[model samples]
Target: MLQKRICIIDDDPIYKLITKKLIQKTKLYSETIEFNNGNEAIIYFEATSDLPDILLLDIEMPEMDGWEFLDEFCKLEKRINKESTVYIASSSIAIEDKLKAKEYKCVKEFLSKPINLDKLQKIAEQN
Candidate 1:
């Protein structure tokens, strides 16, 4: 299996912990990084030369929401790695949110929250 670096950008610590555990269980990622919000992730992206191969983002956050992150990411897209894949992993079931996600070309998929191990495995396989 190809071991990739995965980044989880969510405000909920519990969610982050659980997701991290699940990601580890998949055994497909070399490293897992967590960010409290989109802003922190953006800062990391700006500073780090080693960017994540996969990004799991939450729509609702304190510092900067997922949508805001997408916007900022778009601006920094040129500087960042084009191979990086972004997935919007939010609890939101709103159709509007899903539609909004489609507007961003960087987003590979809009996944519902509480992503299971199977989903993680599939994501890893696809990428």
Candidate 2:
């Protein structure tokens, strides 16, 4: 079984499918859990005993956006452990958004759409 568990929070079904396939291709993560929105993801985290090793978050969604999630996530003292990490996976090109993400300590990087093998490799190497 794959050892690493990764969580993806995004609204687009097509994007989630493609991302899951790409991550599987890398053989990096053992488990991939997806949420259509940040609220759902938060609920999962609250209910589960173990959190994913990494979180791929999107800035836009119907229920809860990335920014709102991060704000609420930070307040969840029991949610994240030091072993876990978060990344902003967004199609947004706005410099302000990127800068805003950097403000979050758990966020490692801001990734643009069409995340490639090279980027995935780099993310894998971070841990």
Candidate 3:
């Protein structure tokens, strides 16, 4: 199987750290790229057209929040980009958050914090 790429965008280092560790344990991807916030990830994607196979984004960030990132990202030349699997990982349980996440077509699903292997496997399948 071809190794998949997964990007993690979160301001929390612990989330990024644990997620990366979990991903490594899965041995499911060639690499897992991480960003402390959404703007950094957006900047990365803008410079590099080779987008990840999947994206794990957090809703809240200091700059370029997840919603903004999604809005700006989808507007980019859709032809030049492949459909990167998106999973919104957040601690927010607000119904509004879930509803807002679905507004973006790129988002495949939303998972609450403390992501586990099961969620990772499911996201892998979605990829």
Per-candidate alpha-carbon RMSD to the true structure: 1.1, 2.0, 1.2
lDDT of each: 0.91, 0.84, 0.85
The best candidate in terms of TM-score = 1
lDDT (tens digit, per residue) of candidate 1 on 4-105: 889999999999999999999988999999999999988988887556889999999997999999999877777665557899999999999999999998
Whole-model alpha-carbon lDDT for candidate 3? 0.85
Of 1 and 3, the candidate ranking higher by TM-score: 1
Measured against the true structure, the TM-scores of the candidates, in listed sequence, are 0.95, 0.91, 0.94
lDDT of 2: 0.84
lDDT of the structure predicted as candidate 1: 0.91
lDDT of 3 by residue, 1-127 (tens): 6779899999999888988999998888888899888788877887877788898999899888889888877865394557787889999999999999888998989889989987887777656
- Model 1 clashing residue pairs (backbone): none
Candidate 2, residues 44-97, lDDT tens digits: the string is: 877774678888899999989999998878766344554468889999999999
Best by lDDT: 1
Candidate 3: deviation at residue 18, Å? 0.7
Higher-ranked by lDDT: 2 or 3:
3
Clashes of each: 0, 0, 0
